[model samples]
Target chain A: MTIAEQVGAPRIVPGRGIPYPCGDPNLPPAAERQWRRQLVQRALDAVAVAVEHPTIFEVDDVNA
Target chain B: MRIVHYVNQFYAGLGGEDSAGIGARVLKGTVGPGRLLAQLLGAEHDIVATLVCGDDHAASHTTAAPELLKMAQAAGADLLVAGPAFGSGRYGLACARLAAVAQAAGLPALAAMHPDNPGISEAGDAPVIAAGATAREMRPSVQRLAAAVTKLAAGEALTAADGRVIQAARVGQLVEQRAAARAVELVLRRLGGDREATEVPVGGFGVVDPAAPVDKAASVTVALVTEGAVVPAGNPDRLESARASRWLRYPVEGADTLASGAWESVDGGFATTAANADPNRLLPLDAARALEREGAIGRLHGEFLTTVGNGTPVATARRFGVEWAAQLRKAGVQAAILTAT
Candidate 1:
């Protein structure tokens, strides 16, 4: 559970942390870029759907 | 261009929490993050002075705005850039207060602070570039604010699309449609037992508890306000096509009515031809005047506030109401009739 879950944020895009929540710093730079892009895209898509209740999106692929 | 920078004690390379009580002081050149803003501003703009003040001192009632503005003027500054104050509540308030003072002194200022900061809500009409919750987002915040400052110096209208400045509210682009046509369609759909969308959110079920009913409608002064962007034909103030931050007050002091061609609608979201040809359509002052003549109301406020309702966010709408209501209250207008398009 994320802070969004803890606080019951009406909407949440799960990639979170103090730093590098979505992408691991130890990962190869190229892989990190891919990981961050997909995470951001999910956040964008999540904004389009209006939700009265808390919802968290999981981004795996760019199109996901 | 001479640019005056502002920072708190810590960013001024002074002591941290211990230095929170320091009085206002002016440094010769860019300190701390002003260097970064300078790099973004390039060599064309001089980071002429960095005015430092303690967060507590700046936030408290000690009064330093006049002197700080005098310092900026003495430096011959063309613009003032204050901190991207992040989530520091006091620091954000300080930057916002300084921004307002600079604007009053004929210098455009830009600052940044997180949306979560209480200062942002109290920032008045001062435009703040969005910042993150901590210094970790400092670079991006500075970059955005510098970009906003550059655009502002060039006298450009920076809207929500610009990605730099954050308006109090954020509204998305909407397709144009007549209210009558949409309403008919919604009615038909609902009759067919299908869910229908609404033009305005009526979560309160389109029901509003009326204000304590005026005891004597004929005795109260009433004010007219509109979000229809109706104004004198020249469009002098150049309010944004969207995401507007300010409103214009058109004095209706003696005029009994608005004549066609004397006023026009500049709202970008809707068809303005009709509203322009007949300004009273968006702002029903003519009708109100008739009501006043019929002894329905005692007086009509001299001036009315007008702003663009097109694509305005709820927060920004609330902001406009707060400011406009204060002005109306000060004028002793006991009642108001607000219209929106």
Candidate 2:
């Protein structure tokens, strides 16, 4: 959301996913950093916003 | 040649939650995912800097977005990239927002995300989202999206993300109904109805009891004029073409000051100045305070809400309003009536 606000970009806030935001603090440094980087990068690419059902942890094909 | 990368606390080398308390920083190049993205680009792109901030800090500061604009301007990055943010909602939303900000500023924005990531749809066409999921997938995703960016930078056309970026069609540009309209007479003929209209214009059908009369001695009615005429005659709010608008809210101040219309226009003809210069900007604050003083309302909300609505997608605009309303509620605001100029 900060990124959106920073760019004065428009975005929809989804209901609670992670307050600290991406990458659980409990993980080891290297793994945690990698996870954090990926999530942040993916977010940078998002041009739209939306919510979801289970909210997190989903599986399936790319086109699905 | 330069690119600015935005990342969450953890990616900025700020430790996780426990360390996430750390401050924000700007770096020279790819730290973690930045490195991967650089590699993915090969020799095609040059990422000059990375700006990392605690998600909380970015989320709380009203001035943060403006601060980011300054940072991007200072960096002079031709391209801006945010996170791919697989499933983290806030981070993902942040990425999408930054992309819009950059795009609004006339820079191409690129980000990656899982197909199911919800922020992609909510952000409303600010970033060029590439396919893939999970951090382990960064290399390829960045590579692909960056390729698209290069193509764009070169003034070359490229195939779209297929369906990755959830794009909204322009208003009045029939989306779901894409087929051309049938002949006017043929369509009107089909719409012709033989039966009389059955519905009433109003919905309230319950009987009304006798109206309670107000005592002349006890009743008082207060009228407040918060004529917040924030306009940039030509609606300069629309900073760019419909697709890439880096919105900059130039204030419309001073109700007494006379101005001429030039930058843009809406249905009304009032001239628009940069939001920072407009005298009408004071109208809301002035009115809110006066209303509060008169006991018409308990308190005035701090800082009038502002945004450049030109070329803004309906979904994102609605989201912004809802989010703003929620925040106002937390601050004890119960109701608000917005007047758009």
Candidate 3:
């Protein structure tokens, strides 16, 4: 996350980790896919919004 | 002090660009600009031998440096000097390489070139005296080289104040306080309204103005790019698992999702077991494709670009970004989703 900020990524959405950025292996296949869908959707929404600087778009903020 | 000088064929009075294919050879002494340089260094410095190499030959061959250094050592050289190559790219690079080899061989060395020369990056801590853009500034360039040599021969440290190009490397210095104590002091200073109390200064990466927001996500072609090292099964293009010098693109025109057996993550920075089991976790191709179908996006780009980011230099990453962005723009890609690991 700090790496993204340091590199000045304009619209940042936090990822799970290095191994599974979109999906969680701990979840069931269906749940994993659903979680991935949400994460990816958040990324899509991030691109649609304009940002003045490197801004983090939290999943909670997106959900709200 | 006995000095051995390195110069390109042109500077050695051995013809012009047509002679660039000629291999390395040694001239007896004081070829072309070496005479001016010798005069600038005064009577104490003797340019014992002049090593002349064709730019084309020097740029392509790595074996030349050690051989040339041997010749210099045989000539009883106390110092190795390479061009004030000025704006010439190949010559500057050759000079920089020679300086590096000389330093490793325990022969003190100095190179002169324009600071913006691409060779500056290859210089590796060797002193590079700032020169003008072309030979038109030869006098000043030689003067700077002479001044640097005088100090070096006397066992003096060359600093930026001496007109030596400071390399983009960190110099270690012993500090009186421990790291934890320093950190606490810095924080306390900052809390006490010292806004600029930073021990480490962040730089190098330049600010990029954010691109305008996608006016309509449902009508733009979005491409997926990744540093997750997702490549075709068997790693067909052989995208490096670490410090990737290049990026590869795989066709996904007819594919709905990245199947487990069809693609895998080979990034060396992290364990790939999870990503290999489900490549889409790193690329999110399945999710992206679904989003396209659901009208969240207009369409998916036919191919996705991938490269390993593990331990890759920032400059290389920036170059890849620029090239990819140009290619994407040419393909009418309005935006890109770059996934990183």
> Taking the true A–B contacts (Cα pairs closer than 8 Å), what share appears in each candidate?
0.00, 0.00, 0.74
Q: What is the full ranking by DockQ, best candidate first?
A: 3, 2, 1
Q: What is the interface RMSD of each candidate, in Å?
A: 22.2, 23.1, 1.0
Which portions of model 2 miss their true places by more than 4 Å? A1-64, B19-24, B115-118, B121-125, B157-159, B162-164, B168-341
lDDT of 2 by residue, B194-213 (tens): 23333223222121122122
Whole-model lDDT values for every prediction: 0.69, 0.47, 0.84
TM-score for candidate 2, please give it.
0.42
RMSD of each: 21.5, 20.1, 9.8
On the 0 to 100 scale, the lDDT of residue B28 in model 3 is 93
Docking class of 1: incorrect
Better structure of 1 and 3 per lDDT? 3
Q: What residue pairs clash in candidate 3, if any at all? A: none
Model 1 regions lying over 4 Å from their true place: A1-64, B164-341
Q: By summed lDDT, which 10 consecutive residues of candidate 3 chain B come out lowest?
A: B318-327
Tens digits of lDDT, candidate 3, B88-145:
7678878988898888888999899988666666677678989998999999889888
Best by TM-score: 3
Chain B: TM-scores of all predictions: 0.50, 0.48, 0.56
| Best model per DockQ | 3
The segments of candidate 3 whose C-alpha lies over 4 angstroms from its true place after superposition are A60-64, B1-203
DockQ of 3: 0.57
- Model 3 earns a TM-score of 0.54
